[model samples]
Target chain A: MESQNIKKKSVRKAGLLSLIPGLGQMYNGQQLKGFAFLAVTIAFLIELVTIGIPAFQDFVTLGTVPIRDHSLFLLVKGTLQIIITFVFLMVLILNVSDARQVAKQYNTLGYVNRSARSMLKNIWENGFPYLLTIPAYFVMLFVIVFPVLVTLLMAFTNYDFYHIPPAKLIDWVGLQNFVNMFFLSAYRSTFVSVLGWTIIWTLLATTGQITLGILTAVITNQKFIIGKKFFRIIFLLPWAIPAFVTIMSFSNMFNDSIGAINQQVLGLLNYIPFVHVSDIPWKTDPFWTKTALIMIQTWLGFPYIFVMVTGVLQSIPDDLYEAANIDGANAIQKFTKITLPMILFATAPVFITQYTFNFNNFSIIYLFNSGGPGDVGGGAGSTDILISWIYKLTTGTSPQYALASAVTIVISIIVIGVSLLTFKKTHAFSNEEMM
Target chain B: MRGILSSTKFNRFFSRFLTYLFLIVLSIIIIYPLLITVQSAFNASDLTAFTLDLHMHWTLANFQQLFTQTLYLTWFKNTMIIAVSTMIIQVIIVTLAGYTYSRYRFKGRKNGLIFFLVIQMVPTMAALTAYFVLGLIINGLDQYWFLTMVYVGGGIPMNTWLMKGYFDTIPRDLDESARIDGAGHLRILWQINLPLAMPMIAVQALWAFMGPFGDYLLSAFLLRSPENMTVAVGLQQFIADPTNQRVAMFAAGSFLISIPIVILFFLLQRNFQSGLTAGGTKG
Candidate 1:
């Protein structure tokens, strides 16, 4: 108790000391934490100086060889090193601020400097959550954050096939890729058309899913329907099957020459009045391919909605319907008034997510027909959404990495903007307050 | 009165008839491709094309070929290693993250949440080049472990959100008492909240399993060796060759992969549905 009367440390002093990376924590009597921070920051700096600096130097020199030699490797290495340094700097700042806050608490509370053991105990108590989450953050930093940063920076560079690193150095050409995409005649037309189709596909596919799902759920929910569980499990099969497998299987079945639909089903339909069914060119012709993609997506997507809507439907209180019944509302009226709004209200965020998902539903398009019909030109096929187009641009015969990066940025902007807008309307963020 | 009753009865009958008719048609459309897949898997012909021939003989040769002629068993082994490892690690990381986000009030929490949401908007495929570069930097270019890390990292944001939402529902009072009784944060999370959040954890685990299992593009990009390929990538290779389009074998492979997944979904159907709707609406 007598030690509690000792003079408290100033937060500003502590902050200034922490500029040396843990000196402040030591001054504030947290030796172990201070030493740990000091050790980590010093190691980080050491690595940057030893490895990062040389890579960056190599990048600046554009390799020892002539510019004709590929130096994309050095550029990538340097860029990654720089990004890592930036993250470390952020961590350093956070550490300093945290030390300052703790020191300030000590000052205000008149908490006397505790022994090293007690300080460690303090960390164990208060820092446990951070400790638990650090591994996740570390993994995410490398896997998600780092890659995203690289992609963003890669957009500014010319890393296309022509500049394949090791033989040719990629130069930082800011906004040239964007200009090429939006202004250049050859690229712009393909960009516009692909974007248009992407939007159309998203809208049509989502609406189809929602319509089919709601209808299925409503019918299944009817008291007259028998074996409801059986119907549901059957419907769930499409979603239950791995989507890639299904898409590939569908691709095979839609094959023009020997496909089941063409050779068997359409062959049967050939006998129908006024129908002349032949090989439908399901994956080849542009028009038919797009149509097939939409249909398959709808099939793949609707089961999820059906499952989600069924859950929502179950939660809808029966009293509302009873009240509506008292008002003499018919089945259609009840559906439109009570069921629809409630489901929409509960599922608005998911609806937006569904749209965004379909917008970037790359695997289905890539696997189903490889975004084919190949006639759209400029490495984009008729069914190529922004995602698949980006994929093709990077992996195509003449890889346009810069253009792909630009497209990625564009797609990110669209998705984030739209999601934010819809999220606001749905009050998803507001729910965080309740927690 | 008699006439009116009869009319109402007729209307009810008609509506029920229409419902059945609609359901039956939708079921056919949905189930037809799967039926064809089954048929193709059994069809003995080397040609993978769908035939209308009713007399086509069923045989086990396609499955036999999948096991012997291709590296199907090796692919399964690789896929299981990746998926299982990813699922276990992901469950741990996501559980901790979700609990942190749910139970703690700290500086930068809101910013962290926003960061997750915004970051998730960027498609993982958008970073293909970066992934390759990352693979090189870590010296894990062709390793299944690297792919597992990617899958785990990719799943974190959504699973974290889901777990957080679930944790929010658990009564804080339960943990409050534990805290008063000298339990630390980790203890409370482990002893009090974990059991309650098992459903969400299970849901996250299932999804993590499926992520690596269903992925084609990433596996194709990361793993170049035929023996290292996952089922999805390996099967695609079977049909990808123009000259050797082993469609029947591919069908057999696809059928084989889907069996366990479909069975798992069935086992976890109720939990999966609740988990999805709960995350979508409440989280």
Candidate 2:
């Protein structure tokens, strides 16, 4: 009798393990896990039986529906579902555990009869890394992955206000939402217009911010500049403060009636003959509303550019500048030849991201005007971006869930397309030394 | 003589004067809004107008009313709870993921890294609708953990990138030496890697702490019930509550809210700047 027990399962057993959820564990000689998996299956089956009966009765009869909130019942069902889900997860984990143990035993001991103590020890030692990853996996799955999947599913269904709950069944709608967005009468024009405005807004705001930011950084970084530190800190405040506060503060400043920008800053400054006054209409007017958004965005955005440029500026070898200077390069020539190219190359990815970010910049636009002056006739505000429009569709009084889902898919496609193009072209991602 | 006249002393004097002038101008730009906010917060008026003259007539009435009349405390408590929980969860997860990505040469390491990078590029709006539906599902489950999970989820990718980059900069010899000393991966991470990554951890903590503090969209959407309202969402009620257009209260609230962030900014600015600047454009 060999000391190392070389026990093996039949092919049929292996096939059975593949068929059943936890049979793999039992085959690997973890009976407890297999039994636990069976128990959870039974429990969830019971729960489904319990909830399905009445829910089915109400749905099929359609004459005399249950006259209860069923909140408690739903709660119980939800809890059971969660528990079942958890147990299913546990079974999965145990299967993996058993497989790993079996593999390790085969490798190290050449047998299936490794002591439980040794098994436990191996798990304790090598398993911590795997165990440590559980939270990350759980968070990503439940939080990001689950929701995204659910929303993707919802996009395929009629989960609008009319189809809230028990009263109505949310049958699949296919690509009707997308169809509605593109060609349908209700939203086609509004969607196209809002999307156009969004693109324009993103372009203007991002460009303005980057332009101002580079200008400020250039000016401040100059040897001749005074109070460089002070200017730097001042410029950085927008980045420091929560964006909500900055936008809110500026919105108030740009308010039509009592806004300080109008009443004080501009009111005082615009009195001068050279300055074009005529009451800038920061909020109400279409052109000025967009302008206000751009200005505030510029103010908020420039700081990041400043910081990035500053870093790039510091890293730029002084020899390049010295060489350029020696070659009789004027300040403009030197900046054009050396500074501009260097910073652009270093920050091209960030520059592209800024555009995409502004494209989806919901917070500022929403807070600034709630995408308002409402698109009563045109369907969205002069300042309304695609993101805000989506927000309106989702949270609007009518609650256009299907439409919102369509918008989401559209935005995702656009973002994915743009990012892929950039990634492929610049290989900006190749430099992302992830870890 | 001319060269001597243009010496270090003269240059220093000239620079000093310009510095002072620039500082004064920039300080005004930075400090003016803050002053206005503070003044507006203290003003006792029907309309919280930003009038210098009116602002001069400061009063504690706005703060008094905020404490006395509104759900400000509840909002504060909610915001703090959310922020703190988010910070803790973020630090733990980011710390783990970051270290793993930084040190471990696992099979899916490159794939995972690129996945996170692309995911990071996916703007909040793209995923937001999905998140809202997620919230509803979780809310259906009747758990606060669901919303917390979302915050933690959104934060992990960015913070992981940040912390991972920071971790990569830490010398690998420490991990190697720890392994030689009979410490396991977790033990080494806990005992050695984490301590070295503290500054980056602090940066992660700050951003996570501020996340729930300033967020409005998710909180507003997810936390439908008034009792669960964060300060950011609660503050919005002031504007939407047409009867109570006490814009001063919003300003007062804004003023109060800005404190922790300001302190955080000043305290963590060094780590924040260094962490972002150095790790952001890794080649």
Candidate 3:
């Protein structure tokens, strides 16, 4: 498809010209795009020079007398500025490459230099994807990326309650918070125990949901079952309701003095053999609270699994089961060999995500009991998982920002690590062939 | 052996009975909390009402008090505004992004996809410190718009992935033909791909709407004033405060809020199932 007649423009020269942000695009006859890129990059640079540099310098030199007291603010602002600048630099590079590629395309097409209007038309046709995605990028940059960067930066500074910004400067402590959390303080024990509970909760909640879900799905899928639609809708109630509403309602229902569970449900249980109860103290008692939380999670989680497994169950070919039956395989054998493996294989990635979700299941812990029935001298509660513990550390009376940030980093690592490992194993990220 | 099995017909009856029993019991367990919430909302009690005493006086006092004595209406209004706005914004952004990612073979596309996947792993609360700092800078604390922005932003990564997956299933020949007909990219996306992917889009919109409707922590953090608070945060105050144990009123409020959502869920149950399973069993 290479054209022999057109004079080819040097891609390298075009790329070099893009150091001015739009020059290369202009050379490639993409005036509007080049100008747009140039304008945005220049505006970003201008902001960086006038405001970002001063803040960054203050961060580096620890500031002079007037601004010295605002070190934390300056540091955070400067770091954010640097991140934005880096983003623009990447954009600049992208601009250069894009320009070079367009020029080469033109050369191949036998078009020496397209007219300005046709160039605009080309952009409107081919550049639509980039144009459409700009808003998404803006949202991601400001909302997710910027905040995450600030949190990461905050981990290195002593920006806790004692170092309230603008009132007292928060200095860079250089892994001191991590040291304190791991080795130097009581927080070490809390972190360890919370991590332990987090894992335990994730395992129990996830497995319980999957087990109950599969059981229900198997039963509901039975031809013997009547009123299948009614049962399905009823079963989905727990999942259909907003989780926070149900969680909070459960919290009240588990109240020892006035709660329905203690007042009516357990009161009836007292009549059963070997069962005696004054009250269960469902939320206040550490053991019961954790157990109740697990049960509640199971109730909340199983329906989704039920729905998924049901879908998988329906999709499973009847011929396999028919073959097993022909071979004289019993119902239990067919289930164990056929249904179980197929469902697990199909939904393994979902199950892993469910595990990860339960690991960070903050609302259930926080909303139910505020991570309460306090344990270990108010640093955390009995039900406090890692995410809830982080919440408490950040929002509690002492507001330990650095410690919280460190914990956040730890949680991110565990979550990301598990997700990556599981995604690889399950081939969750593999591409589906287009139909 | 055949005669012996044929003689034990009662065993088959018992097994079928057990299955039904198990299902019925589990359904009750699942629906019990909802029943209690509904009952409590109508029960005329100033405090926690646990008894099954259906003969007790039923009144609309709790609902009346919920409307008149609290900022319930304001909170409801605020939540509706946020949920609707977030839904619209998130749908638009993710639709465009998803279409772009699906149809385009641009530079950095692979890295961009990986970036989104990695970003999804980072929980939003992990970046609370940054959001707090940002709120202070933008003078956005206590504002619904800022909270809306956060919700829309937070929903994009996962929703975009979902939408892109849905888009992939729609044959590209449609877009090719549209281009042949001289339709532009936007027209093809809006007219061709979108109509086919309507189920997934509806699912995304529902989730986006429900996210802010149910979110407690972020709303509580970003919005401080009572009037500005969303329903989730506002309802929690009834039970959260030590001095004010308003369980019945909270129940009433919860019931009221749940009606529309439950109706929506039932109406779109099929779409919900297909969307979730498709998104789940696929990428």
Candidate 4:
């Protein structure tokens, strides 16, 4: 009873001492670990008080003085400091937990606390995964989280054209940008129009490519077709070229006056007696620009879909089609009932990504026409999607950083919502079952 | 009339003809711009820049000019540095994380994965301004290593998912049996599991390597120096100005750079398909 009481006291004592960083480990007879942790914790605490608290203070105020204190700098510094504090707290919790675990083992299992050298030697096998993943997570804290946090915070601030840094200070403006973006007539209309086109572009381009890909795959898969390799190689040729290069090439070739599409492409198309060709305004008009974009996207993207669908088609049993034929199914019926469902089942997740991909497709729009044939309105071009518009806002001579960030948040919500739904519906997001 | 009454044979022939015709049309549509690009690359005609100058004086002069007169070679070197480094870093980190995620079930595993998923959905481009600001803070705007690390960081979430998914499909039995034989985790991974997972790793490596080549917006925004531009950014500069656009040189440079990549792309076509469906979006 006396020995049990002493053991119980030791466990509780270990837990209590952990509040001072490394004291618990020392109590548990882990001298090396205890000293290392104690030293590091003490050093961290010193810095936390000296730099961390002041950084948070500046983060809240942005800066008490203008010009002298760059708010952007203060904002960035404060964010980093906050991340550091969070990390420190996490480490502290882990250290406390470790101390308790060791103490419990001693009390319950009569475990011996191993020598520091032995423990250190065994650490690799014991903490292999954690050690390896630490660098990745550490980099992510700054690279992903820091930037994302800054952008999110910037949305609530006044960091636009008028509030150019160094000369004038930026301040937190709490939904002012959101209000102006949505409630204000000018910005609201632009948003609606751009968003409408964006939706249309995503739908039309993605669907067009998928449909074309499926159809081509169906045709190519027909055993009656000859030179299957040749046809497939030709079909997938465009995919070999990078998207930006292809888009840029199309941009030059679709030029209003001297572009090859107006002369060579159409002239060749008109070779068939049934087809007639005329000069289409690929650049000047909004309607044609949208049309051309969809076509170009279809042309650029179909190869990927074609490749995927073909792979799916090859694995699909010939007996399914043979069975359909025995059932007196016509071509359309066989396709609708068998081929379509099989392909969709196999390829739906990727297809959903295509929809989202086209939704935010920044490069194609920007590279194609510079989101071109500038809108009659003062801001965004007629062809500018939300992403390209955001690019325009943050870049160029006069940047609207705060407004762009607000738009970014809006885009984030929509994209994340779609992605979440997709992830939830498909097990693609999780490896729990497989693992 | 009697011979013509054999409609089935005629139907087969006619269907074959229609299929060929349709394929030919698509083939032509695919090939037209490529042909024009080729033509412009070789055409030494000052009379017409982007037109279908059918009577082309085929010259390798444009290719020569692309190397000598411009920063094409420099941009290629810069891009390769970023791409290769990003690829190496991503592979190391991704493989490590992937192996752990598949084998281990420690605290925050599920949360970590979910965080990766959610974070990737947060558009990399959405944080462009912040990244630019970060560069300013760290003074890494021109630093290739910085850019490479940023690429690795941005890619980790989705690439980890891809890697983990692929690795999970690798049986735990290999690991168990290896451990039974007294092999450590690293040795088991090196000897047994890694070889099996090579195809997936290769796919991941290729995707990671290809990223720096395709990106324009981020590279353009972050890189301020003239010599620091990646191929994506530098190539665009050629045709940025309409009056002074080096259309021929642009064509030549694009053509030159594309050959090897395109060949590599087709060669690994099968591998990439697996990677594509593994839920990665470079956008």
Candidate 5:
């Protein structure tokens, strides 16, 4: 027992030994793990040095010469910087991983020489989940993290038209961009109006869908409802189709001159003959645009609600309704007392997600209107949500990367705040049903 | 024990009739556009004008023209390449990741899950700038492999959790038995857990396949060459470009695009529903 104890180090010494890559493993007596980390570090440094030298040389040769044309210097430098950083991070993570593995082994076995065959078998059994996760981590880093970092950095810089790559150098502008967005009246108004519309759009779309969805679920779940299964399937169909397809089809449907809804169906079923179909301003009028967006959103969104509510509805046992019936509860009374509560309880977290989802429901607005009538040349639309507005802000005239980043920061704050709130309210949001 | 209406001794058949009438109207409201589009795909005349007039000059000429004129076949080929490649890579990655999270007690298991969750909340659009830059840096953005990489990355988080959830549902005793039988981790996962989690695998693959198909924005922004465009982007270009503003072509093209997904949905709907139900019910 004393000899076994001699093989393991205290946790404090093990932690302190992690200052150098894989040293913790060496401290924990894991010679192989420590060696592997050392090799990886050396290899990464070698690779970085190899790629970086030429890049530095290119940058020096092209130093401060404003050519107004493309050069390989910026590309090379950027590539080198990314590679160095990435390699650096990979090493750090790998070292930490090695240390953690050593610590785990030390906890159990008191030494790292713990038979390679058993270790291999254990890894073979448990390695799949780790293997699966690594790609996702890389992807999440590249796609989500890298871009977000770039955007955040761009917020502090003047990376606009003049600073376009291969041209004049753009320096850091501090919080000036954010100041301009907030303090400048023109920017503020546009931001406010666009934000207002986005809020309205999210509310109307989500509320409309949820209300109608619940109502439909209730009706369909009722006893003696013929073809209930058929209705449920039909209701779920809209959601099954791609959002782009639905929006594109609906956009065509609502067209005033050439639209099927305006011309053939509405014309044929004309309860009011005086209002000509050709004169309808479904896409043009601001009121109609907002209405059209809401209506289209409802069509796209209701099916999700229908599907969720169906799940929630089924979870409400038959005995509850029977109990309600015995208590002299009418249909509406039964719904209020039993059904709505059960559905709401089960679906509140989903409902919060619905709110956040519609907050960025870009496909509908972009595909439907392109946030249009051009906002009467104001560069936004009556139906433009915050996400589409941010998109336009980035891609539109003058290329407001700084302003867009500020907008993103604000959006991040709101989203995080809402997420925390929702998580607090529903344990499911936090617990997340881990497999 | 009985029908509410029948037991009332007062036949409120009018309300039932009205409800049916309302539902029928609503169903038509939902279904009419699809019906119109299907009809227009067959109509010989140009449907670009978006006319309400149901001029039923029925012909398969639009479908015939689509085959003759466009690179529908090329687009189909490219889409299949992207979708299939993405599915293969994504399934392997997600399945492994899911198994790890389910079975292993790693240091950052909670943190990793949180990271994925927070990352998922960020819009895909947020990554466009970095993605474009990364592609340029690596010289990979324009290639088929690059798109597949992006697809795998994009699918990893949600799909991993989903698979993890499935793996969680699997009894650990299976693993114990496999281990006692001298099966390795990979062997157990491949031989036992994978087959048990086939529904999730199908769902993951289906989602991965559908991703590259439905995406227009990413493919459009990233893939510079016309040859690289997926069907969604290509078809949209067909509608938007004046020379190819053939609306009937769009319909026909959409019909073609819809085929795989429709088939996918029907074939996997039962499994998909059961997976979803299991996910919801377990939580």
Candidate 6:
């Protein structure tokens, strides 16, 4: 009973000490952890005072002195500082909570006498996971997360052609870029058409590939099928080749006059009386361009789904099909009831991601035709999806960084929303994690 | 009854023949361009035409020109540097992180995984200016290491999840028993886990190595100098101007790059099957 008072007192004392960032661990006799935590917190504070606060100020104002202070630099630096601070605060919280928890553990289990060597051993053994992952998080914090934040923040700024930094400063113009994309007269057509095509492309191209893949898998996996290995190799060829090469080749092949598609293959069709149109204008005509893009994508993408479905197909129990046959079910019935659902169930995540992939399939669109076949008046071409258009805006001589960022955020929202939906639907894929 | 039996036999034969025929036609569609590429690279006559001709006018000139007239060697070296760096870093980080997520049920493991998922879904190309700005800040603009890190960063989240999934299929009893034997965590991972996870690691390594070969959008955005350009970006310049496209040379370059990768893909077929089922791309 009396020992309870002492235990409670230690817990409260540890909690109080932890408010100073590392004192609690020292009190708990985790001397190294205590010192490391204190060191990190101090280092963080040093960085925060020296650069973080100033960067925050810069982020807020963008730039006060145009020639001297580059707003773009300030924006990037400030976003990095904010990310660093967030990481620091998270560590600080962990430190404090860790102190309280360790104190409680000692009270319950009874404190063991600690030596310096034992303390180091304990750290190596206990902190192994953190040791492994910290380096990765540190790398990701700058490389992936930093850029994302800058793009997201840039959406609310006017960092376009005229307002570029060093020569001129960009200021916050919240949602004006999006407003112009939707409500304004000039951009509305391009924006709507590009978005509509993006949706159409994602649905048609991804589904078309998956459907073709499934069909090929079913045919090739037939019990009596010969040379299965050879067919698999051949089908895998499209995916095995680098995508840019294939896209580049397809782009060359789709040329109206020089390309074999027009000069040879379509020429044979032109000899037919009703189909006597000499040229299809595969590049110059937007409709044919879109059609060619979809066909090329279907060709490029089908092999992956084929490989995936083939794996799933082989794994399906033969007994289920036998049972269906016994029930006097036809081939289509057995497929619809068993094969299709099983493959779809196994590959649902791939389908979602493939949609995301084709939605932003920049290489296929850009390398194929540079998203051309339309006037550049509205900052996009006839074949331009939002992602390709964003690329053009970001890469052009006078890049519209603000507008591109706005589009990126929109893509992010759609992609993230779909991924999140998949996540929820899959129930976080617990993966036997509870074990 | 005998007539019906013969009819059924005939029907079976017809269906089997149709299946074979359909497969053959599809194979032709996919393989014809590849055949054209090979033919053009050797044909000597063709410069820009994607010909379907079977006639031979073969020469080693296109490959010879690619190495001499262009910066193809330099581009190949640049691509190898980036791909190899990204692959090495990706393998190390992914295996380490995979071990942690699989073996340890530490604080925020679930949350961190989900956070990474959300972050991973954001397309790498979406942050174009930020990448430019980041390259500038790090003095990495046009630098191979910069592009390598971006590749590592872009691929890490998905690769880590895939690795973890692979690791999960590995039994925990081995590790638990190793822990009882007083083996250190690193020792356990090195001796038992890594040896067991070799297949997944191979898949991961191969995918990472191939990424730089096809990447144009980001490489183009970050790299400015001709000396630093990767093969994908370098080869495109051959065909960039409509009037000056050297299609034969482009074919030669792609032929060299694609054939070896295709061979590797075939060799790693089973490893790839499992890896994709666990949700990693061919990459």
True contacts kept of 6: 0.64
Whichever of 1 and 6 has more TM-score, that candidate is: 6
Residue B58's lDDT within candidate 6 is 84
Looking at model 1 chain B, which ten-residue stretch has the lowest summed lDDT?
Answer: B45-54
Residue lDDT tens for model 5, A1-435: 644555555666666676577788777776766777778778767866886565555444433455642333353354446646676886787676667666776677655654667667666555555665777676666666666766665566666666666666555678887787777877777778888887888888999998888888777776788888788667777766766766777777777666776777777666676754444688788788788889888877887677667767876788988888888889789878888888776667557667877887777887776787546223567677667776776667766655666777777667768766776767755455442
Q: What is the DockQ of each candidate?
A: 0.68, 0.39, 0.62, 0.51, 0.43, 0.59
- Give the per-residue lDDT digits (tens) of candidate 2, residues A273-374: 898765677777777788788877887788888887887887889999899888889868988999989888777767877888888888888888877764
Better structure of 3 and 5 per lDDT: 3
The segments of candidate 4 whose C-alpha lies over 4 angstroms from its true place after superposition are A1-17, A268-276, A317-330, A376-378, A426-435, B1-15, B47-53, B274-283
Please give, for residues A155-176, the per-residue lDDT of candidate 4 as tens digits: 9999988887777888899999
Compared with the true structure, all predictions reach lDDT values of 0.84, 0.71, 0.83, 0.82, 0.71, 0.85
Of the candidates numbered 2 and 3, which has the greater DockQ value? 3
Error of 6 at A129 (Å): 1.9
- Per-prediction TM-score of chain B? 0.94, 0.88, 0.94, 0.89, 0.88, 0.94
State the fnat of candidate 4 relative to the true structure: 0.54
* Candidate 3 lDDT by residue in tens digits, B44-119: 8566544455576799999999999999999999999999999999999998998888888876678788788788
Model 2 chain A weakest 10-residue run by lDDT: A63-72
lDDT of 5 at A98: 62
> For every model in order, what is the iRMS?
1.8, 3.7, 2.3, 3.4, 3.3, 2.8
TM-score of every prediction relative to native: 0.94, 0.83, 0.94, 0.92, 0.87, 0.95
CAPRI grade, predicted model 5 = acceptable
Instruction: Assess the local accuracy of residue A324 in candidate 1 as a C-alpha lDDT between 0 and 100.
Output: 94
Ranking the candidates on DockQ from highest down gives 1, 3, 6, 4, 5, 2
Task: Answer with 2 or 3, whichever has the higher lDDT.
Answer: 3
lDDT of 4: 0.82
**Index of the highest-lDDT prediction:** 6
Best by DockQ: 1
